[model samples]
Target: PMYFFLANFSFLEICYASTTLPRMLMNLGTQRRRISLVACATQMCFVLMFGVAECLLLAVMAYDRYVAICNPLNYPLVMNHRVCIQLVTGSWTTGIPFLIEYTYQIFSLSFCGSNQINHFFCDVFPILKLACGDTFVNEMLAYMVAVLFGMVPFLLILGSYSKLISIILKLPSVTSQAKAFSTCSSHLMVVILFFGSAIITYLRPNTRHSEGTGKVLSLFYTILTPMFNPMIYSLRN
Candidate 1:
C-alpha cells in the first residue's frame, strides 16, 4: 500500500510539474513571455486540477501511513488493492468539478488593463488582479476553494500524523519507534514543504508587495518541491 500510494504520488508530481515547467522553459528560451488568454486559462485549469489532486492525494497518503503504523495487524486487509485504488481514484477526481468551475469563473471575468500577468504562470491572484470590474466574488471563491481543498486536506494530514506519533511513542521498543518514524518522515517533510508554501500563496491577501513573494513561494511548491520529491523519497530506501 505504501508503494502504491508512492507510485501515484510520483506520477502526480510528474504531471504537476509538467503543467507549468514546459511552458515556463519555452518562454525563458524564446524570451516570449506572452501567453494567449485561452492558453493561460487552459494552463490554470490543469494547474488547479493537479494541484488540488496533489493536496487530496497527500492526505490520502497520510491516512495510508496511519493505517500501516497504527493498525499493523489489519494493514493488509484495511489497505487492500481495491480500497487503495478507490482512494487514489477519489483523490484524483474529487476536485475536478470544483476546479473546472473555479477556472471558468476566473477566466470568464472581464480582464482588462496591462494584460501582462505579474507572475511566471497564470495563478489565481495574479489573474484576478487583471480583471477590469469588481472581483469580490472571484476573490471569495478563491478563498472558499482554498479552504475546502487546501486547508481541509492539510488538517487531515496533521490529524493523521498526530495520531500516528502518539501511537509510535507508545510502542515497546526504540527500534520499533524509529522504524515507524522512518516510514513517514519523508512524507512529513513533503507535507510541510508543499502545504506550507501553498497555504501562504493561496490564503494570503493579494497585495503589490506580496506579488514578488508569492511568485517565490509558488516556485517552492510548483517547481522546487516536485524537483525534490524523488530525492526525498529515494533517501528512504
Candidate 2:
C-alpha cells in the first residue's frame, strides 16, 4: 500500500516537472522566447497547481511515515485503502482553486512595464513585477495563498517529523536507530530541498539575494528538486 502511494507520488513529480521544466529549458535555448498571454497564464496555473500538489503530497507522505513509525501495530488500520485514496485525491485536487486564484490575480494586473519576465518562466513574483498599477492587492493575495499552501503543509511536515524523531529516539537498539534514521533522513533531505527552496522563493524578503539568486532557487524547487526526488527516495531507501 505504501509502495502504491510512493508510486503515485513519483507520478506526480513527473507531471510537476513536465509542467515547467521542459518549457524553461527550451526558452533558455531558443531565441524566440516569447510566450503568449494565454500560454503564460496557462503555464502559471499548471505550475502553481502542480507545485501545491507536490507540497501536499509530501505532507501526506510524512503522515504515512509517522503512522508507520509511531503506530506500527495499527498502520494497516489507520492507513487503509480508502484513506490512501482520499489522501491522494485531496492532494491532487486541492490546488485547483489556487490555480484559478493565482492565474486570475496575475493576469488581472496591467503589464504596462516590460512584458519580459525576469525569470526563465512565468512565475508569480516575476510576473508581479511587470504590473504597472498598485500591486498591493495582488501581493497580498499571493502571500495569503502562499501561507495556505506552503506554510501549512510545511508545519505539518515538521510536526510529523518531530513526533517521528521522538519515537525513533526511544528505540533501544543501535541497528534499529540507524535503520530508522536512514529512512527518515532521505525524506527529510528532500523535504528540506523542496520546502527550503520554496520558502526562499516565495516567503523570503526580496532583499535577501539578487534576482539571479531568486531564479536559481526557483529552478531548484520547480525543476531540480522534482527531478531528483525519485532518485533520492530510490537511492536512500
Candidate 3:
C-alpha cells in the first residue's frame, strides 16, 4: 500500500513537473516570452490542478504512513485497494473546482498593462501584476485558495507526523525508533521542502519587496521539488 501510494506520487511529481517546466524551458530557449492568452490559461490550469492534487496527495500519503506505522495490525484492512482508489480519486478531484475558478479569475482580468511576464511561466503573481484593474478581490481569493490547499495540508502532515513520532517514541527499543525514523525521514524532508517553498511563495505578504524572493521560492517548489522527489524516494529505498 505504501509503495502503491509512492508510485502514484512519483508519477504525479513527474506530471506536475512536466506541466510547466518543459514549456518554461522552451520559452526560455527560444527567447520568445510571448504566450497566447489561451495557452497561458491552459498552462496555469494544469499547473494548478497538478499542484493541488500533489498537496492533497502528500497529506494522504502522510496519513497512510501514520496508519502503517501507528496501527500496523489494522493497516491492511484500513488501507485496502478500494480505500486507496478512493483516496487517490479524491486527491485528483479535489482541485478541479478550484482550478476552474482560479483560471477564470485570472483570465477574466484585464491585462491592459505590459504583456511580458517576468517569470518563466504565467504564475499567479506575475500574471496578476499585468492586470490593469484593481486586483484586491483576486489577490484575496488567491490567498484563500492558498490557505485551503497549502496551510491545511501542511497542518495535516504535521499532525500526522506528530502522532506518528509520539507513537514511535513510546516504543522501548532504540532499533524500533531508528526504523521508524528511517521510514519517515524522506517524507518529512519532502514535506518541509514542499511546504517551505509553497508557504513562501503563496502565503507570504504580497509586496514589491518580496517579489524576487517569491519567484525563487516558486521555482523551488514547482521545479526543484518535483525533480528531486523521485530521487529522494529512490535513495530512501
What TM-score goes with each of the models? 0.98, 0.95, 0.97
- Model 3, runs deviating above 4 Å: none
Sort the candidates on lDDT, descending order. Answer: 1, 3, 2
Query: Per-prediction RMSD in angstroms?
Result: 0.8, 1.5, 1.0
**Which lDDT tens digits does candidate 3 get at residues 1-237?**
788888899888888888788888887799766778998898888888888898999999999999989999999999999999999999989989877888998899887768888776778888999999999988898898899988999999999999998999999999999998899989888988998998888888888888888878888889999888878888999
**Residue-level lDDT for 99 in candidate 3:** 78
- lDDT by residue for model 1 over 1-237, one digit each (tens)? 889989999999999999899999999999999998888998999899999999999999999999999998999999999999999999999989988888988888886688888898998899999899999998998898899999999999999999999999999999999999999999999999999999999999788998899999999999999999999999888
Q: Give the clashing pairs for model 3.
A: none
Model 2: per-residue Cα lDDT over 1-237, one tens digit each: 668778887888888788787887787788678899998999889888988888898899899889988998999999999999999999999879867876887798787769788887888888888889888878788787788999999999999999999989999998998887886777788899999998877887765346888988988987888878878888976
Q: For every model in order, what is the number of clashing pairs? A: 0, 0, 0
lDDT, model 1, position 111? 67
Off by over 4 Å in 1: none
Judge candidate 2 at residue 230 and give its lDDT: 78
CA lDDT of each candidate? Answer: 0.93, 0.85, 0.88
